[model samples]
Each structure stands twice: as C-alpha cells, then as structure tokens.
Target: MERKALFFLDECRTVISTSIKKVLAKVGSKPVMRVNIGFSSIYVILAINAWTGEVVVSLAKRPNSESVKYFLRYFKRRVGSGRVYMVMDNYSPHKTKGTLEVCRRKGIHPVFTPPYSPELNMAEAVFKSLKNYMSNKIFYTIEDVKNCIKQFFKENKYRFNLNAITYLGLDKIEV
Candidate 1:
C-alpha cells in the first residue's frame, strides 16, 4: 500500500470585532475596547500537513457543503497526486453527500474525531493560535480581518507542529 499523507482539517469563524479577554486595568475603571458595531463573519477552512506543517487556507462567507467541497478540490490541487488521510471534526458539511463524493473522487479520506473531542484534531490548535492572534485586535472591515488571518498564517507557517504522535498522544498508546 502506498503511504498516505496525513492532514488535519477544520473551520474557524472570524468576526470583524475583537474577542473579549481579561485585561489589566486600573481598579474601578473598565477596560475599553472599540469594536465594529455590525456583525460580519468569515469562515476559514484549513488543512495542515501533519508531517510538513504546510497549511492551506480558504475563506468563505459561511461553511457549507459547497464551500467544503471547493476547499477539498483546492487542497487536492495544492498537494498534487497523493492518497491523503484527513482528520477532521464531524461538521455537517464535511459529511454531506457532495463533499464525500468529492473526497472519493479525489482520493482523499476523512477520519472524524470522536464527538466532544476537539483536542483529538490537531487543526483545532491552529485555530486556537489564530484566535489568540486576533484577540484584542479591532478590525474595521472584514477585509482587514481577512488580511490579518492571511498574514498570521504566512508569518507563523513554520510554527505549527501537526505531528499526531506528539499532539494526539498516539505514541503512548500500545497498539
């Protein structure tokens, strides 16, 4: 059997406003955070190569079966011809018939993490890092948020370690 490349896939929603976090302020004085008044969100769909730390990201207005399938095709093109094993959460779009058909046609396999077990998916860590980077930072428009996300991934591309044995503790489990 040919060795398959491993990747962890996930989606994160980023808003144009900053995330609320505890801040150090003078007693009796509330910390002030200026935010955009209206709601604007973008979904970031990504796949992280478990061995190479290579990241592929796509932005969408919302995460749906069509968007997920599009990202899968994009990811397949980026990775070239190879059997891929993708670990992901059980998101509704990920299991849709269209998305599965795309996977089947592209030689991609989806392995879902157990319910309520986000930690099992290494992609969650990438999302957490992205959220932390975006926290306490105000963006006036969705484009600003999108640029920030793109910059974050470009700057920190080498920082991600998606090794399953290290992150999922697979090495400790006696097979």
Candidate 2:
C-alpha cells in the first residue's frame, strides 16, 4: 500500500445546462430550453486508489447517506481496511457524521481536496478528458449515450492507469 490516500467524489447531471449555455458553449442568444426526457440519469461515485491505479465506478440515483454508506462498505470489502487512504471532495453527504463515523470505524481515513479547487480532483479531469474524447460523436438514443460512456471507460482503463500512476498523484508500488 502507498502512503498517500485515494480520492473520492460524486458526479450528477441535471437539466441545469440550459442556463450555462452561454458559458459552456458558443451558441445563439436565445436560450434553448432542454426538455427533460425523464431518463434515469446516473450519479457516479468513484474512488481512485493511488497505489495500484484502480478506478472504481459506482452508480446511484441520489447521493445520500445510505448511498455513500453502501459505496464505502463495498469499497472496504473489496480493498480491505487500513490498506488504502481516501481523498475526497467536500460534498454534503460525504461530510455527514454517519458517513465519516463509518469510515472511522472501518479504518478508512478520508483526506479532502482544498476548497474551490476542482483541479485537485483528478477524477474530474478524467471525466472531462473522456467527454472531450467523445465530443461530437453522434448518438440518437439514450442507450447509445450509455454505450458511449461504457466504451469510454473500457478504452481508457489502461491509459487511466498510466496517468494515475504518473501525473494523478498515485505512486507506483516498489517491489
């Protein structure tokens, strides 16, 4: 195990891009209201282990205490306690007493990124890079979108290892 901790965070998308169009893209002045298609948008909570460059992606609809609890439990069971550290962003549910308490009881120490610094969240960069890689690819249906994301993860898993080990604060294990 490495001396540094893993990083954790959750990503959720809403129809909120309508208002940010001007900032997010170069578009006409008229705001195009995006219709809510009522698809089951996923919330992904991911953990990146700094030692081995393993990226774990977990899906949820809501990021509440129970969801986080389950994520942590699954993580601990898979990785074991006291072997890895966790670096995380300060989301409310992540800061919940119940969640922190569970981490403490389970021997998983959680480190946090600095306030207002998304750059420190290397996982965010992974998503941004992947999306950019997928940009302008046409997909007519929701399943297409799902498959695109799946393919992105599959294609980048090894590249993710290289980046994670070199530039993303993860260190290679010395044998």
Candidate 3:
C-alpha cells in the first residue's frame, strides 16, 4: 500500500457540550439536562494516510505518551514492515522524547502540522464528522456509543474521498 504522511490531531470536547451550552439551552425551573454516558470527554485521534485517504482511529483517551505508544504499535501492526510517515500536531505527548524514540524504533516518521492551524489537520475534521454524527443522541451505556462509532468506521472508512481530505490540507503533507 502506498503511504503518505498526513496531518493529525485530537479533539476531546464533544459536540453535545456545544449544543447544551450554545444552541438549544434548557429553560428555567427543570433540571438542566447534561449529556449522559452517551458521549465521552475522552480524546480520539486519527492517523490518516494522505495517499489513500484511509484513516485509522487510535486510542480514545488522553493524548498521553502511553496512548501515543499504543497508537504507534497499532499502526505498526497494521502496516507491517512498510515504512510509513505520520503527521501530527505538536502536542506534548507527541514531542516527548519517549514518544519520538518509540516511533523511531518502529520506523514511523512523524511530521507536524504548522503552528496554530487547526484546519490543516484532516484528522481533526474526521473527529468533527464523528461528533456531528453523535450529537444529542443519548446512549444508555458507553458500549452503545462505542457500537455507533464502530459502525461509522465500518461503513464510511472506504467512502472518504481524497479530494475533501486534500481540501483539509492533507495534500500538503511531506516526508
């Protein structure tokens, strides 16, 4: 498979929060409704391959060093022995020496998005789309929300077009 480095980023704030605070606000008297276990405050990351516009969702938690390692390992297994390049924001975990060393050992090259440009990270757009799909829908348990997420990936992963991803600055990525 052809490999290309692409911008990456994480978004933790759920769309539900925006709707509750901005769009449809609760009226007076009744208890203010909060998004239940339906949505997580956890960070979700995507490692997008620019060449094919194929996105691999990583750990759905904080952007910590351990989480980055887990993602790298997952990526390594997915693309065994194929040298690959990845682009990501300069988040603290990404910059940590341990994280860099792990990537180096795994033959994964990391590129960074330009400073202060969120629009350039196509992975962020992926999460936004996921959030848009999840907004306001209540799930009795976290597993229910997870099933929805899994379904989304299964159904739409191949449908993502390179043209739209390029618009999100994915084509700008380089080795």
TM-score per prediction, in order, is: 0.88, 0.66, 0.73
Runs of candidate 2 with Cα error greater than 4 angstroms are 1-5, 12-40, 137-144, 158-175
TM-score between candidate 3 and the true structure? 0.73
Best by lDDT: 1
Of the two candidates 1 and 3, the one with more favorable TM-score, higher being better, is 1
Model 2 scores worst on lDDT over the 10 consecutive residues at 14-23
User: How well is each residue in 1-175 modelled by candidate 2, as lDDT tens digits?
Assistant: 5265564555644221111222254565654444334444445566765545567766666788888988888878877656456777787788899999988887888887777777666677666655565454545454555666667777867236534456544566565
- lDDT per residue for candidate 1 within 74-157, as digits (tens), equals 999988987899987988999999999999999999998888888877788899989998888889889999999999988986
Worst 10 residues of 3 by lDDT: 13-22
Model 1: worst 10 consecutive residues (lDDT sum): 157-166
lDDT of 3 by residue, 112-161 (tens): 87788777666766676777777656666555666667777778953356
Regarding TM-score, does 1 or 2 come out ahead? 1
Would you list the rank order by lDDT, best first?
Answer: 1, 3, 2
lDDT of 2: 0.63
Q: What's the CA RMSD for each of the models?
A: 2.4, 6.6, 5.6
Candidate ordering by TM-score (highest first):
1, 3, 2
Over 4 Å off in model 3, which ranges? 1-40, 163-165, 168-175
